[model samples]
Target: MKKIKIYLDYKCFPIWIYNDKGELIGNDLPKELADDKQADEVFVKIQNIYDNLFINDLIEFKYIGFSSEIDREGYLKMIDDAVKLLKIKLGDLYVIEEKIEV
Candidate 1:
């Protein structure tokens, strides 16, 4: 049996989009904020879009890692686990597998 491997790539941003005075608002930092000379003084907790999704438990397989790539065996395993855990059809997902000479 091939072992399943899954890699998670995270795009994270600050959790708080507002300024200290509670004026500016948004999920991302505005240009005004970026232009601020004191921008370095601002600090906020960061979060990933994946954090908003409740599928963490489903994607958190035993072979999951924080790398950008996974081997063929690992990818297959992840697909199988995802289908079984999410109770979804394999056809619903899009996957491309290729062979590398290296």
Candidate 2:
């Protein structure tokens, strides 16, 4: 199987679009490597999985507001859930590895 490594440093933000002074294009990689339209479609689903991670921000706010603290377990669970979902989506297509920065 191939490999898909996700870094935790991007704040779980999904940046699939590339915009510059004037030019706008879809960021490449998973899409570029996707050789067929079907593959691109699958990647779109995968992109959504990553995109949803952005919600963690709001969740974090809720946690802090309710408890005045950061719930480490919940925080880590969010990441773990994302990883599991990624693996399910990827199936055998690629190996999923998450990189966390300390």
Candidate 3:
């Protein structure tokens, strides 16, 4: 299992996640606002379990509106595009990308 390394700009509001191979897996908003409190805790758990996610294995992350304002729908779409890019570039090794402003 390969864990992905990802950096989240507190300013961006979508959850960003990566695998060990440095690939974007999944990004989306939380189920609700109240869930924000538990975002870090849940993320830690996710990391603990998926510390090393294999290639092709989806690793989803969220960019909550915590540190800054971000486009919810756009971020999600970015995640989708990132995943596709990873599949194409890494194929089944690893995928990772930097957060960009759209």
Tens-digit lDDT string for candidate 2 (1-23):
34555453222332133333323
Clashing pairs in 1: 4-74, 4-77, 5-74
Off by over 4 Å in 2: 10-70
Q: What value does the lDDT take at residue 42 in candidate 2?
A: 41
* Candidate 3, 39-72: lDDT as tens digits: 4444444333232222332675443242223544
Decreasing TM-score order of the candidates: 2, 3, 1
Q: How large is the C-alpha RMSD of every model relative to the true structure?
A: 18.9, 9.5, 15.8
- Candidates ranked by lDDT, best first? 2, 3, 1
TM-score for each candidate, following the candidate numbering: 0.20, 0.41, 0.30
The residue ranges of model 1 lying beyond 4 angstroms of the native Cα positions read 1-12, 19-24, 33-55, 59-102
> lDDT per model, in order?
0.32, 0.45, 0.41
lDDT of 1: 0.32
Q: Is candidate 1 or candidate 3 better by lDDT?
A: 3
lDDT of 3: 0.41
